[model samples]
Target: MPDLEDLYREIILDHYRNPRNRGELDTPPAVRAEGFNPLCGDEVIIYVRLANGVVDDIKFGGQGCSISQASSSMMSAIVKGRTTDELHRLNRAFKSMMSIEPDPDDPAPVNGNGADIKLGDLEALKGVVKFPVRIKCATLSWHTLIQAVEEAQTTG
Candidate 1:
């Protein structure tokens, strides 16, 4: 388990140092949202393009700590080409894993034994919950992503 945790750390660091999708999209994006953690000065901007109810493309630009930057990078990679529904599920799962309580009405599965409950590389972030202070660092981009996608659905 420790080895796996180390691997997860390595993955996070790699993404932070060499982020993926760390740029603005050339095409006009369907929606964009910015996230800021005033406590630590973490900021992120998310750009999303939806097509046929799918996340056709996504990108992010941000300046922050390793956790924040890596979270945004990993989020962009995971959400690309996923359906809006899938993105919502992912958002719920991620938040729950980070110890964020879910609303009673939120149908988002919380690590239930469902076929769709896979977290993939995003699982690397589950450990952030251990450090409550760092939880926001890891979640800043994810929350921004949800905001961007929901806003896009409303306007698109």
Candidate 2:
């Protein structure tokens, strides 16, 4: 039987090889944000839809490594249909995860609202913390999602 780490690697690879939500939205009211990891030339585009204080939809498109692709797939799976505040908290929590700054168990607290991202399978990505260069790859989707949410807030 493969160990947990090996299983995690397979999960990541599976997500990368056959991504979920790998496409563009149709004439979406959503604003798209694109992110690039200059070091690896990895790119990700995040699209978000907000309607009445809640996210109606989310999608992503990009090309990159297992880390980036898997992270993007997971992010898209979680971020859609969340409120703006929820999205912000999720964004912050993801940053904290990549930065290795906040405790995933506790999540990064958001202002005084007491809301936070509930990191799930994403925590498996913690192995990425040991690889600095791979950090950007792991976080491309998250950063792009945040940027897209910001753009939606301002222009959408």
Candidate 3:
């Protein structure tokens, strides 16, 4: 078995090598949002399917680093079956864990337990905080996801 760090590394690499929900969604009423990490040139486009005050499905398209790609994959997986409120909360938790500020009006990454978060796999990205520029790479997808959620609430 791989060591803890190794396992996390593998998780990161696996997500990078083969991302989930990478293509666009075909829904007519889907809301689209975009995120860009100017520091690393990381970018993502998020599509959210809104129905009954929930996110029916989520998808993403982007080019970015391992952290960004992996996070996007994970985000898609978790948000697909979640409500808009749940998604918003999760984003707040994620942003908190990432040490980003929590401004009420501004859309934030999830907070609290981050139910959908796998700590070890995500811990692999902890090293990113050490590199300021790379922080953007790690957060690009999450930023996109937040945009997608916000757009869903407004457009849908």
Write one digit per residue (lDDT tens) for candidate 3, span 109-144.
444545565443555666566676776777777777
Off by over 4 Å in 3: 106-123
lDDT of 2 by residue, 1-156 (tens): 359889778778877888878888764597788999999989998877888878788878878778998999887877777776666577666766677453334333555332344766676686898899998898878767767766776776
Residue 96 in candidate 2, Cα distance off native in Å = 2.2
- The runs of at least 3 residues in candidate 1 whose Cα sits more than 4 Å from the true structure, single-residue gaps closed, are 103-116
**Poorly placed runs, candidate 2 (over 4 Å):** 100-117
Ranking by TM-score: 1, 2, 3
Q: Against the true structure, candidate 3 has what lDDT?
A: 0.73
Q: Write out the backbone clash pairs for model 2.
A: none
| Ranking of all candidate structures by their lDDT, best first | 1, 2, 3
What is the per-residue lDDT of model 1 for residues 48-149, given as tens digits with 9 covering 90 to 100? 999989999898997999999999998889889998878878777777778886445544554563335777777899888889999999999988998887
Q: For all the candidates, what are their Cα RMSDs to the real structure?
A: 2.1, 4.3, 3.1
After the best TM-score superposition of candidate 3, give how far the Cα of residue 107 lies from its true spot, in angstroms: 7.9
TM-score of 2: 0.83
